[model samples]
Target: MAQVLEFRLPDLGEGLTEAEIVRWLVAVGDVVEVDQPVVEVETAKAMVEVPCPYGGVVTARFGEEGTELPVGAPLLTVAVGAAATGTTTGNGSSGGMPSAPAAGTPGTAAESSGNVLVGYGTGAPAARRRRVRPTASAPAARVAPADEPAGAAEARVAADIADDTEQSGPVPVISPLVRRLAREYGLDLRQLSGSGPDGLILRADVEYAMRAAGAAAPAAPAAPAPAAVPGPAPRPPAVPTPTAAPVPAAPAAERIPLRGVRGTMADKLSRSRSEIPDATCWVDADATELLAARAAMNAAGGPKISLIALLARICVAALARHPELNATVDTAAREIVRLRDVHIGFAAQTGRGLVVPVVKDAHRRSAESLTGEFARLTEAAREGRLSPAELTGGTFTLNNYGVFGVDGSTPIINHPEAAMLGVGRIVPKPWVHQGELAVRQVVQLSLTFDHRVCDGGTAGGFLRYVADCVEQPAILLRSL
Candidate 1:
């Protein structure tokens, strides 16, 4: 008999709790190999392919595409062992699961993947999976029916376990959704006992508590019971006040849900606005020389140097002088974290949404290398294949809004990072060249920096240095 093993959604890291299934790579009755990506999920950060650790015939899948599943929810069930090799229901039916798979074949008891996601694998410690069966008194702690939605089942379990479990030690909560729910309602997790195994707090527990509190609230003081029985014949039973007529409901407007990449961008931009006191300083530079320099380099070089890469090189040089702009504000520690490596992120707009893909160790790369990385990341962004790791850990961002045909924009700083350099269109404009009127290639450069990190003087200096480098590309040679 094939023993079926359940695979839960592993933690995708970056503190993400839930993910919406965008596409299912494997279907029930399909044989899968260990470390094979079975599903593509979109989290708040990026689109990720979730690889299953067990190699076997997929017996059943949990959520359909577009369904948001919480962390630790069962993603699918796989039947392992030699018994699964030749057995397939004629109509591709998923039979009942027997016992756990014994070590026989790949994806069986002995063979499982070493990598599923961060901090998760088939080889996880047995202590993490240990469970004690609920006693008769805890009748509510039964397993959810197969057909029940995971959220609903979890909520039900949580509500039932809240009253039965004793609370202690770090408030056994694993789901980020539960934490968010408790936070939104201002419920302290420490005060409530969880209704999950090992006293784990669940969403239902919070909802139950909220409902109980609402039901227990005093009801309008019973309208004061009409005071005196002998009040002048009860004042003719006092005419009741007229109630307002019900108004017709307004037509519902189309609402785009703030979830996935767009949702994450909204949150990050909002946080950047609310938390960081930012300041923008812009300067127009004559880039005629810079353009000529790039052209000359490309003519003599083995690899074509991109304009953005040159700008990135300029940014690296400028940051070397102004390290304050290459750091983040550590609010909790009350310190400024100056990063040693320059991982520059550039804004890339894709079909999914606007995403900033970071080029790691950008300062160490030549203009040619930076150009290649930027192209690779851009392609990945457009294809919706960027990982969360690629989407984060940026020290500074270079936003070339020029490609959009825009002259200038006060770009929002990609949050946590102290500053961003915005490059506008490098158009030919009439200007005084060498004290003579001429048409020069001019571009507007703007720098938005966290005011908490530096004052206007430092920001102005950084922007000024960048503008200088753009006007005279030779100025970058000193730093190089």
Candidate 2:
């Protein structure tokens, strides 16, 4: 008999709690290999293809396309092992089906891939499913009892496995959010009976425990407690009061949920605004020399150098001179953490939303290498294939909003990072050059720095250095 296993959505790291099923790769009755990509899911960070850890025939899928599911929610089920076979005679007589594989029987193929996400799947072989004995009055069915509803047998078997897990090992909790909730309330997960499939602890279980604990707590003192005791008392139920006649109901408005990449951007921007006291300093630069230099380099080069690559090179040089701006504020430690590596992130707007893909070890990369990396990351971002690792750990962000045909913006600092450099569109403008008014390629550059990290002097110097490089590309060669 095949051992049916339900696969839950694995934790797609970086603190993501849930994902929207963008697409499913398998259907009911389809055979799947271990570690095969089963579904495409869109999380807050990026689009990811979740793999199934079992090799088997798919039995069911839990959610439809565009349906959002939490980290621990079931994604699908697979029936592992070989199916029981039987022979029948033409005379209405039948040979009995072969007995199911015995528990831990040698030569019996294992069912799991042993590959899984964090906090999921034990490395040990899957627990052997108990064989059901037939009653005197009832005949043994091939897969399940005739009267049992679809999936009911699977549920029972899963629950049995869960019971064994709960008794012998760690609590069956897959979601970090659920664990965090329990931790916050000082609730013992082992003490509470899980309400999720296979006795898996869920966020709801933790929340219910918290509510129960709150209800069972002793009433607060008659008056406010001393300041040492934190948290305000629970408000008493409000008394009824006379009110005016009920107003007519308003029409429902179309409300877009802040979720996926959009939601992540909103949260990060909001957090950056709330936590960082930021200041912006901007200046217009004569980029005519920079453009000519890039054109010249490309004309003679093996690999063409991009304008942004040149700008990035200049930024890296500027940062080396002003390392204070290339640092982050550590509020808890009361210190400014200067990062040694320059993993520069550049803002890219995709079909999904705005994203910042970081170029790791940027300080060590050449202009040609930076151009190649930026191209690769931008392409990945457009295709929604950029991983969470590619999207984070940015020590500083270089945003060229000039692509949007804008002059400049007070770019918000990508949080935990100390600063952001925004570049506006480089356009032809008349400027005083060599004692004469000449039309030059000019661009506006803005530096947004966390006030806690550095003051205006450092920020201005960094911007000034970048502007000088753009005005005279030779200045950047000195650092090179």
Candidate 3:
């Protein structure tokens, strides 16, 4: 007499209604241990491999790879019998036992029933369950320690084992897609903040951080000391930095279906544009003095700085004075969301997509620390390894299109942040200095604001203040 057991899919989290089977690690008639990885599934945000809860000889695979399954759908069946020799057969139609081969050779495997682990199982025809008993004792399934009752030391041990089994390092809650993206971009997953269901790191979270970091890099070069400003100034006309070629477009003009982070970004951007009416203001600032100041600072043994970081620091200092710019519009509540701390999100570009990673407490950090952190964040962002926390809680944003040789363009406000600043390339343009038309390093600045929260006066004033800071970088030291 053999006893039979069935395994169902477990919940992965984040209101996930369904999951597509990525691959099956085990086949029918294979002896599997409890907690062993048996299958991989792709959810809306990330891919995950699930472990088996029970130890038994696999009798059937409920569904094929790529099939979507619902929660509680039977995925596999095992016969628990006292004698190992008894053969069990399943009926091909809904509720029959799977057919078995002659004793000794591997048994014929059963087809998988398409069922999503979270929301709904496929409406495929059901398979009949064959009744069978087992002779060999099946080991009890392992459960997570965190889920266990209080005061159970055994649960703690189980939890430790579970953690080790699930994650390879400190941050084990990330999805497979995030891990893959992080690896491609050379990111360390543990360093990122998770924002997904149950605190899992999603793909969008990683991409956003990478983009922010990339946008902040070129600004550092604008900071070195006059003595350390290596190369002589360009003669008369300033030469533009060459831009990289745009990514090749897909041939045939075929429709590229959106999915994952790209799909989410499209939807979010669409919703933002539809819901939020935006207004922008522009200004031209002479960054020559600022560049000179940065060079002076760099000569003092400070970390190699960039114009972007200096700009970011100035923005944070200014936001402290003008809290209105750091607020979010609550249309439903008809209120404003004013944050206490200043976390400035910078736009970075990655191979997969664009990411905006936030630097927390920008006002408090030293120039050197911020510079190093900017490097770390951007490196992680470009590699697709940003965590969820890094993507959220941004009180403001900065977009640097200057590196691409563009003069300036209005950047869309990242929702919840009342305003965003766009910085363009610096060029030597003829400008009045002390009543003389002298050539100076001039740059265009654009400020895009959520009109509901910020008035034209407030927006323009903020840009003017930024211009003052950029024109006299020495003023930034006083603010700090």
Candidate 4:
């Protein structure tokens, strides 16, 4: 006998409430080790493999691929301390059939996992002094899949019937689908109890309630189509009025749910637009010297310095001069909070989507170190392996849209932070050098800052300093 434990989806931090099942790594009846990558899920932030804390045989899985499950929904159940064969046929059984353990016997080996959420771990099986009497169960046959007898329809019917039971308080819903169904039908779920284990209100319960409500209500007659208009004027399309019969829906288009990495981006960008009262200022910079400086550094370098790192160095130096821009707007307290440290965020586009990876304590690192860190983070972002910590806590952002061949962008502030600096393509352009026109490496730089954090003068000062450094790289030596 073994204890069967259900593992629910853990909170994949950064305010993500749900995730879509991309793939299942372990199948039913498969033996799994503790902390093994069990399923691949796409959250609004990143694609991650969720691990189970228990080491044993997987018994039942809850959702299918492409299904969206809310946090706290069951991922799978495992029978820990049980053999991978899934049956106790040889121990005190008749004719090699699986049998129940004697009551009050210490025969069942069960272990409880302490690390069930973010940190998964394993240890030796713990023996318990208290035990449960083995009930009449089929051991491995404890799982009821969607393809069971009478199929999902029967389960829905049974669950719906159970939904009619009165509850003491609020209904327990495991999936967001159930709540959406009820809202669409205007069903008062407080009056109905749930049909699932522990009174969980499932999608079936909502649909059943919808059908019941529709059946109990009186039907209305359909309105006749309007008469045709005179002459060449086209008659308005006949509007279908509400009736007892549900109108068949048009064939669905290929729809992808906005719930994972893409969804998080949408949310963050939206919030940044809504909460941060921002403004953008741009200027063209002569980058001939900056590019030349980079070449010199690389040619004479122990560790090659990247152009982005040199730009980062300029940004850190500019922030030191214009400290007002390196701050956040404290809306709740109605104050501008200037930060002491400079953690920079750089936008990196990957196959998954656009991600902003932060370089911690960027003001303290040299150009060589910044180059190495950016390379590491960019690789992590492309592979979808960046942790939430690596993706957040930036006081300012450096977005080099130049890599994409763009000339300029009014970059939205990465929220809570006050400002972002966008750099554009550096191409050869005729410019005044020593009062004479000459071809120079020209780049456009844009700074988007929160109005609550600073005024245009401060922002202009920061951008101008950045431009000065680009036009004459030796200006950075003064700060160094």
TM-score (all chains, Cα) for each model: 0.65, 0.67, 0.54, 0.66
Clashes of each: 1, 0, 69, 2
**Cα lDDT listed for each candidate:** 0.76, 0.76, 0.65, 0.73
Residue 262 local lDDT, model 1: 92
In Å, residue 154's CA in model 1 sits off its true spot by: 21
- Candidate no. 2 TM-score: 0.67
lDDT tens digits, residue span 1-480, model 4 = 234578999999988798899999987655566678999998776778998877655657999998999999999986553322333323221122122232233432112222111001111112321112222221222223546565664455336434532232113332324444554455655544554332334455566666666565656788999887678866799999978988899977878666667777778899999998899999999999888888898889599999999989999999999899889877788888999999999999888778889999999999999999999999889988888788888999999999889999999889888999999999999999999999988999999999887889999999999999989989888999
Q: Which stretches of candidate 3 lie over 4 Å from their true place?
A: 1-252
lDDT for 197 (candidate 4) = 30
Q: Model 1, clash count?
A: 1
lDDT of 2 by residue, 203-300 (tens): 55666667766666667679867667568987999999989999999868877888899899999999999999999999999999898998898899
Better of 2 and 4 by lDDT: 2
Cα-based lDDT at residue 123, candidate 4:
16
Residue 121's C-alpha lDDT in candidate 3?
13
User: By how many angstroms RMSD does model 1 differ from the true structure?
Assistant: 17.1
